[model samples]
Target chain A: MELYHRIQIQDVVRLDHAALDAVEAGFRALGQGRVVQPPILSMAIEESNGEVDVKTAHIRGHDRFAIKVSPGFFDNPSLGLPSLNGLMIVFSAKTGLVEAVLFDEGYLTDIRTALAGAIAAKHLSRHDSRRATVIGAGVQAELQIAALKLVRDIDTVDVWARDTDRANAYAERIRERFEGLTVNVHGDMASACREADVIITTTPSKSPLLDAGHLPAGVHVTAMGSDSPEKRELEVSVMTCADVFVADTRAQSESNGELKAWAGKTMPFEVQELGPVIASGQSPRTGHDQITVCDLTGTGVQDTAIASFALKRLVA
Target chain B: MELYHRIQIQDVVRLDHAALDAVEAGFRALGQGRVVQPPILSMAIEESNGEVDVKTAHIRGHDRFAIKVSPGFFDNPSLGLPSLNGLMIVFSAKTGLVEAVLFDEGYLTDIRTALAGAIAAKHLSRHDSRRATVIGAGVQAELQIAALKLVRDIDTVDVWARDTDRANAYAERIRERFEGLTVNVHGDMASACREADVIITTTPSKSPLLDAGHLPAGVHVTAMGSDSPEKRELEVSVMTCADVFVADTRAQSESNGELKAWAGKTMPFEVQELGPVIASGQSPRTGHDQITVCDLTGTGVQDTAIASFALKRLVA
Candidate 1:
């Protein structure tokens, strides 16, 4: 007889700094070549306007690993339901017995993705970075800024969205949460990114929204959206102008992220991975005058890491 | 908020003929090209002697689909644990929200795999088939024979295993459950298969155990054991000698089943899929003197079908 536990979304929403640290360690492990992360298995259900992706990774020597089933039904919002929902199945690596199912309903994905943005900024941004600009005013737009505050002393935020009302509402939400922090709604992408020390793109845009001319010198950018082949956020020139161009994984970047703009051509600059950057103590930014860009298409290591972390918290 | 239900292994063991019919319908749907099943996602944990495979499929017009996590840790039996363990996570096709989690401990897999063997025999074997021979006296060996009775009036059974005592024990168990059926334990594979009208192979052997010479004319063979690249139960000549060759899926058979013996080469006969054959009502064996071989590598449609069926039963 085996025992199986169910950890729900409410239980997962209480994730703290420890959960972020666990995800960071997963990246470090991957960078050190101690993780076996396979290519994602994706299937589209055209009839229901939905798609499902299965991701899993094993961190060497870990007691447990996780296989996450992430499904996105784009039409769910019309049915009075959330668009994204799924869970993580965690198993004991030693015996292959299922330990728990984290029915987080995509909450863990949101947490880990936000944490990845923070991890990128911790290594790439300058210590004095304060001002931030966020493209898109969705759940990720708000979460990315909140996550960034973990590493940088973010005091002011500029938000740009195609919908002005949503952008203003996003600003108001941020203002209520962070006391003394100034939030501004920008009408254009260029104006929003002009004076920012860090810029985060969190849109599901099908075309490039930010180009090389939009970036201020020394500003670090984290493109958190564009996780599918048909979506891209940064222009190709934006990548060419950056001093450091990092990806969560090179293969994913080529097929699903901003690097898809490269069109199978070799990049002019050396490409770095977030895992290696975190594992090694080397900062790609040597001076305050160099631009940096991080492309996050997401990875399986983050899912397993966050799931393992959530299960420990729930059980404890 | 979304609700998730956990249906345990004990709850799943109550599968009956209706559940088997549900799985059979799944195969029919796949055969008719109404299912969208993606390639399997497999990851190996070599250090722990375990491997995990994720399988899912969306059957057209169905309200829900299933993503099954199957992990096999060969060393678990020594630890007083079953070597196979995992569950199926079912989601609503319209919203992609998790409908339920069936922590069935691989009971559903067993039920479906056993039904698949019976399905093949029903479509390919002679209607008057009354004698059955099973190679390897394992759980599947017993289940396959029991499931076969749903299709044929099996009155006698011959079983062969590496260990004769285990074979005798299997015979006794069958005798107790299936009253009026004569069961025999055979020491040699050839003798066990000689006088049988239906032959089912259920072993984890890494080499060929049955050849063309062992298969008598007019006998229908259901090779259910070889589901990995390293395992092969039927010799290539056995396939060549068959009047018709059917696979659960051509792609899986080429990689993991006895069809791997063909080594990327085309077979002399047209290879049919079991689903289409069932859907079309086409019997590959017209006369009682022709041999038919059905290779069972398992499929995602079966998992989704059985999971959906089990959920309906549990909820009701």
Candidate 2:
């Protein structure tokens, strides 16, 4: 009899960069029509002020499993706990049996999202880009940097946060983690936004954070946050300035952020899907100074891709 | 961090009779709106002649969680293995934390289903009933026997199967495990159907196994096998003769067995839900000779109820 293995979140904590790399490959595999991802079902708990989602997918020639319990951890600070919890189960399609369970829900989410950034940047970011600015010095902030490094030869990283101490700490961590990479702790948000070849925002704020006027020409901004309707990370003016705007899903992005603000209005740009860009090589690295922005709303395909990839790595 | 423990299937076997009690309590809890079970989703693999389903449920007042897996064990007989496989997970609604992982997918499915029979019999079975004829002695056949014992005082059980050896083996096992019960093996299906005050069928066949004309008066038949559209345990004539026909869900029954046959035509009878019957004291138990049939197309509510109850039992 084949036994189903249950893995706890406490069992695997440090599945960081290596896991993200595997997840990136999964996305590519998904684009190749090698995976089947069902629509993600999200349950937003208003009373608890949090949300949880269950994502299912069938990775053809890879894995058939669903990622359950990707619940947003809220009350972590007050409860003295991490801000995310849950498990992912890999079930076999051959026998319709749950083969393994992984407990690192938050870490998995982090890596998958970061891998998405890496994928977007690999196709979208300029080849000569060396500096990147990251807003929101939180858990996701560090991951964005890690993912960016895998795509571009990034040397200098500008970090900004509401809490200067946290930003400084994040900068220190980046310096220690990435040897010979200069970590610049910016005092002002606008200063962090300007003169960077690439920029990523990973904040949970409802209003815009960066000043649009501060952005240099030809900058590639990846809005890594702003997942729901209430979230808007990029300034409304940034939407107008962006030469080409790309999104993980046009529907999801249109309801959230600057896209929501610009929706139904006459905008000079066209919304391109991430999958098509990856599929047709449409997301090309243009000239040295072409402005680009990718608004990622996080699709079910990413979950399917990551799950399919992880299962293969585990079994192999 | 709260950790969900895993109970491997090998650690526990013969979870048949054990689940009937829990299933009964779960039904009561379900009527109380303390459980939330979505409808069961399935996909039939036509080429392989197999089916896969993802069964999920959320039980209220016990920390919300859904049990998910593609459980397919119908192919086990051909593979020389148990045909059922899947995983049961209990997750927290408040924190989105997975609390427990039970690896006995098909075992739990069988147990909960049999328990539903026991629950149905507890309210619908004949009083002073001392005999039961199980139509098909497959996996759930023995469980139905155990479940009946909890609700009715049965002194003898007549077992019938397509294969005589399988029927004899089932009868001997029941006799060994359950005290105060005599096992009688039937030469044919009608012999068992002729004497039974309560009839139970647990086959995966598409055609009717027993004759409606052979059924004795006042017998309560619990049809456990016909859940899918292509499967059934009773003939259309038998349903027409039933005085009271109760089902888990009227909508689901219409798509499955007896109802599927009676589609576009008036229902054999106006169906009553199990919830209202259990909540109200109006369940008719006038005598030991009322021909009542409760066709159970297993609901997601049952899964939620049992999963919640099991979690409580584990914690306590």
Candidate 3:
């Protein structure tokens, strides 16, 4: 009997970095127009213990199912378990066979999201961008730094979290990890945004985190926090000031973020999509002074593409 | 990497008698109200060569993906490939883990379907049923014979097909396989149904094959074909004589078959669902002189339940 291979969750955890690289390739594939990601459907399970979020993403061309399970895995530091855990199944489009099973839970998610920010920086951030300001010193914040360094030659990074000690620890870790990159611990959000070329907001705040008054004209902001309707990370005025705005999925981002906040108001710029422009080589990187904002609403297509790519790697 | 167990298609070939037994167990599980199967969503892809069907079944308690792919692998009669070929995947519900993958495909489908007929026979057929007639001399006909024998003591089985040779071959095979089970090759459809205690139809016919007047009193007919709205195997008059009618899914059978044949017209009896009856232990066997009919428009729940069962077997 010939043995058929089964890829497991442990495989996903061990090879998350490689999966991240594969996801970058997936983004490039999306840019090359080989992606069909539908808006994710989030189902909330109200449990007595706590609320569990089931995030489902369907990727058509890749024929994959990526469902994310989030129960605030990181918030409870005593639990010693990551707050997010999920599995992905990549199916064969030719036969509808579930080719491989991946249990990244949230590792691949963080990687893919951080990659999206990097991709956004590649097309939206200035060419000579050196300074970085990341709001929220969490797991995602760490990933953002790692992903940004790959796409930009950043020399200085300002780390700011609600907890001062955690923020300083994150800054010290960043400086230690990347020897040449200077890291600063900012006391407030306003000061962090003042001298940064690229500002990333990943906080789970209802109100604005970064003041629009502190942001310079040419700074490109990648907002990654506002996934749910109530979670807003950037001020409405910041969206108004950006020269060009892009979103992973316009319908999803609008429904979740800027549109949810400014329900009755009209924005200056229409939310352009990332797929067509990236695929058509018509990105918003015309000049260094373009103030672009990319709202990263996580998509299933990326999950499918990444899972498919990784399955091929596992098989090959 | 440690190698897991390997089950090849060849290793499981000739699963006939044993497979039928497994199918009986599955049906009993259904009868015992232990299995929960949801409705299936099937997508038919018609190609110039032939057609392919992709059916997906979702088991609630079992987090496995069961997909049935029926390609036209048997159309080339010269090549001698059987018409149906596919596989099933059983995943672990607890960990969302894919535990085992089986290549039984059509073998399992045939057994389970035939077991459904046997189940119908136990509840719908007369206690003194002695004669059985099965339309369609294909593999499913053999399954019908196998499953019927398990439920009834003595039976003279009549076989009918498009080709006399095929029908005769099937009759000869049944006789040789079942030993004491008497088998007869019928030249015409009407003669096959005449005085038959149980009638099982498995042909992929677009029109009805059995006439209502041909069936004897107390006959229980298992309509195995006409899963889709475009396909049906029993005449409208067949329902007129049916004392009590049952369907796998009411919505599916109503839109498709004798139900549709009598659409907008008043019917003698409302079709009871097999699931509810099995669940509630209320399967009514009218009487020795009352005709009964079970219209099966196969549901996804069966697949899910079966797959879940198979996964449990693999685990054990």
Off by over 4 Å in 1: A1-16, A263-268, B1-15
- DockQ of candidate 1 relative to the true structure: 0.76
Query: A1-316, model 1: which lDDT tens digit per residue?
Result: 2222344545544435776789999999999999999899998888988999999999989999999999989888889988887888889999998888787788888989999999999999887999999999999998898889988999999999999999999999999989999998998998999999999999999999999999999999999999988899999889999999999999999998988887899889889999999999788899998999999998999999988888776777
Q: After superposition, how far is residue B62 of candidate 2 from its true place, in Å?
A: 2.3
Q: TM-score of every model?
A: 0.96, 0.78, 0.67
- Among these predictions, the greatest TM-score belongs to 1
Residue-level lDDT of model 2, residues B166-258, one tens digit each, is 988898888898887888998977777787888888888798765578689888888878888888778877778887788877767877655
Cα lDDT tens digits for candidate 2, A1-316: 2222334332342335565555555555566666555444555554455566665655555436444557775775677766676666655555555666665555566767887887788778887789999998898899888888877899999988888999999999989989999988989977887779999988888888865686888788899888877888887778677777788767667865458867667666777766667777566546677788888877655665555555555556
> What is the C-alpha lDDT profile of model 3 across A63-163, one tens digit per residue?
33333333333343455544455445444443433345454555566767887788788778897899999999887788888888887899999878999
**What order do you get sorting by TM-score, best first?**
1, 2, 3
Q: Which regions of candidate 3 fall more than 4 Å away from where they truly are?
A: A1-179, A182-273, A284-304, A311-316, B1-111, B163-165, B203-217, B224-245, B250-271, B284-292, B295-297
Cα-based RMSD of candidate 2? 5.2
Every candidate's lDDT: 0.89, 0.71, 0.65
DockQ, per-model, please?
0.76, 0.25, 0.08
Fnat for model 3 comes to 0.00
DockQ of 2: 0.25
Per-model tally of clashing residue pairs: 0, 5, 5
- Per-residue lDDT, model 3, residue A25, is 56
Which candidate leads in lDDT?
A: 1
Worst 10-residue lDDT window for candidate 1 chain A reads A1-10
